[model samples]
Each structure stands twice: as C-alpha cells, then as structure tokens.
Target: MKFSYLGDDAEEVSDVLTRCIGPVRVQKPLNTALSYRYEFIAAGRVAFSRATSQGSLSIGQKGEVPKLLVLLPLHGAARVRIGRDDSLISIPGKAAILDGNRLSELQIEEARSHLSFVIDQGEIFRHLSAALERPVHGSIDFTPELDLTTGAGEILFKLSQIMATCLGDNAEIQELPSTLSHLSEGIVNLLVDTVPHRFSAALTEGEWLPSPRHVKRAVDFMHANLSAPISMTDIAEAAGIGVRSLQEGFKRFKGASPISYLAQLRMEAAHRDLLNADQRLSVAEIARKWGFRHMGRFANDYRKSYGCPPSEARRRLPLSDA
Candidate 1:
C-alpha cells in the first residue's frame, strides 16, 4: 500500500508525480536532494504523497484530465495559481484544491515541503450518484482555499493525516480487504459530506431509500459464492426475482448493471487472493485459480482494482516493511 522514491533525477520525480497526481513539469533550481513517499489506497482511485524538494513546478493537462488533486502543506508554504487569477499562498493551516482538467500551476519559491492526495473524479461521481440516488450533474467547484483551522476542513485534514500516517503500522487493517474497501468509502463519504458542492444537499440529506430486500438477497448470494462462475438468471432465481426486476434493481440500487457488479466482485476476490497469496504461487497461477481465464484481461482488471500489477502485489511482503 505504501511505496517510496528517493533520488536526484528531476525527470524521474516528475514522472512519479505524474503517476501519483498529474503531469507537472518540475524544476529544481537549488541543489537539494529529493525525497518522496507515496501510499496508494485500494481501487486505484485515491492516494497520498509527500515531497521534500525545493522547486517551482507547473501542473496542467494538455488533454482533459479526469482526476482531482488536493494539496496540503504540513510545515511549509507554496503559491498556487489557478489559471490567470490572483495567486494564493498555502501554508500549514490551509489546503488547496484543484481540478486536473483546468490549467493551473503550483510553485515553491523556497525549499517547500508538503503533502497531497490524488483522487479519481469518476470514482467520486459514482459514489455520489449512488448515495444521492440520481445522476451527478456537474463538477464540484470546491473553494480554492480551505480553512483548516475549523469546521469540516479541520475534520478532513485530521482524517487525511491519520490515513497517511497510520498506513505505516496498520498491518492488521491492511490485511483485510473489507477494511481497505471501507476506508476508501469512508474517505469518499467524508469528501462528499464536507465539501460544499452542487449536490451538497442531496449528499447531506437525500430522498433516496435503501435497496429492497430482494437485492440484498441477491448480493448475499454473490458474496457466498463469489469464486463460482455464476449468471444473472442464476442470481435472479436464487433471489426469487425475475431477471427484469433484478436488472432494474441493480441499476437503481447499485448504480451499475448486474453484470458489472459481478465483474467487480470477481476482481475484488482476485485482488484479495493476490494479497494473501503465498510466495510460491505466481500471479498468473492465482488469477487462473480464481477463474480469471484471460491472463491479459485479468492483469488489467487487477491493476485497476488495486492500483498495481498483479505481480507487484505478489511481490509485496507483509506490513512489517510497510
């Protein structure tokens, strides 16, 4: 879950930042050593990282970037420019939020050090859509400056610190797939509830009700036999619902079709296996054992679910070194 980078190459650091956050052209004016650490949460949607480098960096997107970047300074200062607007200074008590699709730049005049998080916009949108029981209509125009001294800003800052800091010792928590899933969902929920946005009301209080009992029964069936190759009709028959009703229920309640949910579960199960697998078992062997027939497709799906290749997960040792 946690990886680190320490080197002197600016381009390599830039590439790592591009992978962790966005495409940023980093310039190290002063001769200072670079030290960076990053931890990626599950589902490939969220991550946290820190950089100890003195540089002026430009972050932008040539094409539309489908992600959001949250920048927080723990002990230094930086100036941020959102397009051509007046530059904003961020220090330890404030956080900066930027949409990756927009043209923006972040610069560190001195040897500034800070922490930041990268989030997938589509993943947040999916969760918001599910919680609000409707399609999310627009992008969240977060206040560029977050006052971290009070209210929701304080809560988010503390939670993010806890997550990034505790990752080093939470071996028990890291071993549980459900815990990772819950942690990601909890963070997403915090973001939706705390930030003032277009769907803030629906996020705060929505008219949506929970999914019906039949849907729950179907989900239970899937969980019980997740490794078994199952079909929609099989699930519908077990849940005592027609295929049409089951399809509609999944679309409304799950925000995804039944087939998609099934695939998601399959991928999740495979990912868990990769994490818990023994060193003797190769990634391909584990994938095949879990009924992932196509090795190429399985690798891609596994990467998307866990934010790394299956081989990387297999190579990971226990959290003692995390």
Candidate 2:
C-alpha cells in the first residue's frame, strides 16, 4: 500500500497518515501542509512502513488501544513531545519508539525521512504473556530510553534488513504474509530476551520459568563434547539427575530433549568444523566425527537446520587461520 500527499493542510495530512498507520485515529484540526509518500512493506499483526515527509506537522491525539510505534529517522531533525516532556531526536541514524496509547505529541519540522513499524497490541500481549510465563493482564508501554538502547538499535537494524530483503518490490509479495508473521514473532522474542525489565516482568508473571541449573550444566556438557556421542543417559549422569528429571528439565529450559539437543550441538559443531577446516573433509567423515553415524539422515537434518545442504555450509565459510 502506498500514498503520496502534496500540499499544506495539517488536518488532511494527519488524516491520511492516520488512516495509513492507524489504531490511533487523528483528530480534525491538523494545521500543516506536507508532501509525503508512504509504502507498506509488510502488513499483518505487525506492519512495516517507509515514509518520507517534507514540510511541518504536529501529530498526536488520543487512542483507544495501546499502540507501539518504532520510528527510525534517516534524515532531518525533530522535536518530539510525549505528555509534558519533550526531547530532540535527530537524524542520519537515530530512532525512537512512540507509544500512542498515552497522551503525547510530535512536532516534525522541515523534512523527515523515516521508517516505522506499528505493532499490534493483542499480538504483543500474547507474546509477553508467553515469555513472562504468566498471563499479562495490562498494557505495557515502551519508553524512549528503552527504544534507543543498543539492543533495540540492533533489533531495528535487523528489522530493517528483513523488511528490505523480504518486502522489496522484487520479493515474492504473495509469500510475504507468512514471512512477516514469523519475523514479527522473532522480533518479539528478541525484545523480551534483551530487555531486563521485560525479562524480569515475564519471570515475575510466571510467563518464563527459571531453568534448572542442572539442565544448563547438561547443555554445557553437551556443547563441550560436541564431537563425542552423547546419549540421554550420559547427559543425565553428567547432570547428576535421573533420566526422567533430565528429560523434563531439558524440555522446560531448552525446549528439547537431551538427545535432540545433543544432535543439534553435534550438527552445529560439524558444520563449523566443515566451514573452517583447512583441508576438505568428506561429508561422511565429518558426520562420523560429530557422532552422526548415519550420513543420509545427518545431511538431511543439517540441511533442515541450516536451510542449505551440509556441503553448502562448508563451502560458504573461509578456511581456518590455523
């Protein structure tokens, strides 16, 4: 979806923008004339937008449901006011997340080149509920400080990359709906995991239960011996737990059984070795070295995990310095 509005009239521009990026409907008295073009990249529970605006405008009013807007400004300067407090967030590579569910206002001066993501409240709440391991009954608003953090910046960069790659005009638009859905879920997971406040909230709510130390220790053991065959009993013995306990603990913490985790660890180790080895190794030899005795199943699993055949992963990485 795309729209270009030229000419001055704050109300009309705001109306158009609101209809374009909504849930926070704009009021009728917008007072600026702006020329703008907005393109909808990925739209679903989460919507991605790239918009460029020239002119002046004041945006903000009231809204019904909680709304989260992540805005990255590529050019120009602007003074954004949320409630009674105001801050100057400027261009080139700076960004901000605006929570429109609250009382806030934004004054965009001169020109602004921006990319934004509007996240659905229901979807976000569901994610929060799951991550926190408890029912999230209230709305959570992200502060500007949280939005500007290093981790948030990384997420925004990744989001932009995903949007660029998956929603480009040349991309398969027909497949975008499912792609966006998965991408949105990944974004939520990254946010919940990176933000201490959000992580703590999730823990407090029982949405994310603590993993047993033994389970973590078992995983460490498995990773440390990736080239060795690791059985469920071996992992259980290493963790000093019974087989049933080990299985349940791994399931709760890592979301996989010990044997499955071991297989994944071995596959990862084999892939890395193949990528970095100075001398080329046969697929069978590499699989065997990683405790994968069945070459066919190993190759199939590797392809499923890495989205490429094992040989491709080997070819993609440079030879080891050693």
Candidate 3:
C-alpha cells in the first residue's frame, strides 16, 4: 500500500496520530512535530497509522461518519476518554475500539508508541449480521478485560500480520480493497461467534441492516470506470436508481455523497497508478486518465485531499515499478 504524510511538523504529525490511535507517550515538549502518515490500504477505504511521540499527546473530536477505530498499543500506557468515560489502556497486544461518530479524547504521556487501524463500521456490521443467525446492532466497547481468546484473538493476530506484511512490503495500493475485505470477513466471523449474545436482543428487534448489494456493485462500477468521464447519472443508471435516490442512498449507506465518494475512489486509483506505473506517466496524463481534465483544479483538489502535490505522489511510486 502507498504511504503519505499529511503534516509538515513532528508535533502536527503527533497530533494527527494521537487522534487516529488515541494517546501515546511523547518525549520532548516541542511545537514542531513530524507529519502524520496515512497508509492507503484497502483502496483508501481503510488506512493504518503508526504514531511515535517523545513527549505527551492528546486527540480530540469525532469523525464525520461512523468508523471502527482500533488501537494496538506498541509502547507505554495511555489514557483514552470517550465522552465522560476514561480508561488507562496499556501497551503490547492490548486493543480498544472507539466509535467514529462520538465525541472522544485521548491523552498520552511521554514516550509512547502505537498503531491504529480504521475500518468501516457499517461494513463490519453487515458482515456480522450475515454470519450470526440473527441481526447485530449497537456500539461495541473495547475494554481491556474483554478477552479476544475465543477465535477473536486469532483473527486479530491474523489482521495484525496482514497489516505488517502490507506495510513492510510497500504493497501496491490497488490491492488494498480485496485484501482488507478478506481480513474484515474473518474478523466479522470471529466477532459474530464470540459476541453472539451481546447482539441477540438487537437481532430480535429486527434491526438487521444489510447493505444493499447494489452499493457494492456501484462501487465496482465506479472503480472499473474511474478513468472514464462518468457522472452521477451514469452511476445512478448503473445502480438502477434515479439520480436523487442514488445520491440519498449513497449518503445513507456510504456516509458520503456520490460525487465525493467517486472523487475519493478516483483519487485512490490515481494515487496507486502514480506510485506504481512503469512509464513514469506525467501528471496531466495521469489526471486525464483518471478523468481529471483541469490540471490546476485537479492538483488543488489532490493536495487538499491527500496533503501532497500530485508530483510528490508520482515520485513516491517504487522506482522499479516506474
């Protein structure tokens, strides 16, 4: 998977990392910090972050949509706060889940390190609902006392292995979706089997929410034709829904507008090509290939979204691949 840094200073990077992984130890009290790195895994739908701090750090606020933020501490203990609740979660193999749509804060003292993985909550829930005999609902808390031993541990371990391998190999970013989906399915199955009782009542309530198959199909179509001049109408027609309905459906199901989602998907595709293309394609060529005609506008949007110039993204591609 391709990696990109969003901040220029070490402190800024630490702050982003803290938000991403909760809290971690910091060594020095300096204003300038390293930039945060975002590993574009699973076609950019999922990402993994590694944060290190010499001193103390903290994270505040919630994400725009619901996501699964999983933290695996690599060093020193840190304090995590969700709303009014707080806990001292320690390091090495310890994990915690925080809801993406809630107000939460995290504070890490000096000298801490951690890894965080972001997953789509809705996707996980849908998979869980299918695996279990009944529907699954409600939020999940990742308390330290909760043991992942019953198959869950194995699944987590496997996921961690996959993440490590992907990062270590500098894997192609395009392969992320399938890779992540495979891992997600395994984890969902484990969760269903181990946390079955926790969701029984919600299942009884008939709140089983299955993502429409069309959404996946739409995603596939968008990915396949990302370089083409596709529009909302095309997507809607492909999904067999009217434009308005399609927009609404995407918002409700995917937590993003259709265009925004398409942009993100296209950007991921372009980024992958930029990183792995053998010909060392020009930025204009890449942008045009990805259906971006206006160089200036594309460059601006790219920087805003990915926090780097398109040229930088292209430069990051493996030299051998280029």
Using lDDT as the measure, the top candidate is 1
Name the runs in model 2 displaced over 4 angstroms.
Answer: 1-9, 23-33, 86-92, 146-152, 165-170, 196-207, 210-322
**lDDT (Cα, tens digit) per residue for candidate 3, span 1-322:** 3454444454555454444433323233466343333433332335565655555556555333345666767677877776666555655665666665455666766667666666655455566445432223345443433333335654675566567566544455336566655665655555445543445444445434554766656777787887788888898888887888877766656557788778766776676677677665788898888888789998887765444577876644221121
What candidate 3 gets wrong by more than 4 Å, as runs, is 6-11, 14-40, 43-45, 62-64, 131-151, 172-177, 195-322
lDDT of 2 by residue, 1-322 (tens): 4234554555566666666554233232355456766666435556677767777655675443345666777678766666665665655465666655455566666877777776655466567645642223333645464444366676666676667554455667526567667777776665555544433554555436766788767877887877775677887888889999998876665556778767766765676677676555787788898898877898787755444576765644211110
Which TM-score value belongs to model 3?
0.49
Window of ten residues with lowest summed lDDT in model 1: 55-64
Task: Summing lDDT over every window of 10 consecutive residues in candidate 2, give the lowest-scoring window.
Answer: 313-322
Stretches > 4 Å off in candidate 1: 30-44, 55-62, 166-173, 201-322
Return the candidate ranking by lDDT, descending: 1, 2, 3
Q: How do the residues 104-167 of candidate 1 rate in per-residue lDDT, one tens digit apiece?
A: 7776656666667667765677776567543342356666778788987787787677556535
Pairwise TM-score winner, candidates 1 and 2: 1
Assess candidate 3 and give its lDDT.
Answer: 0.58
lDDT winner between candidates 1 and 2: 1
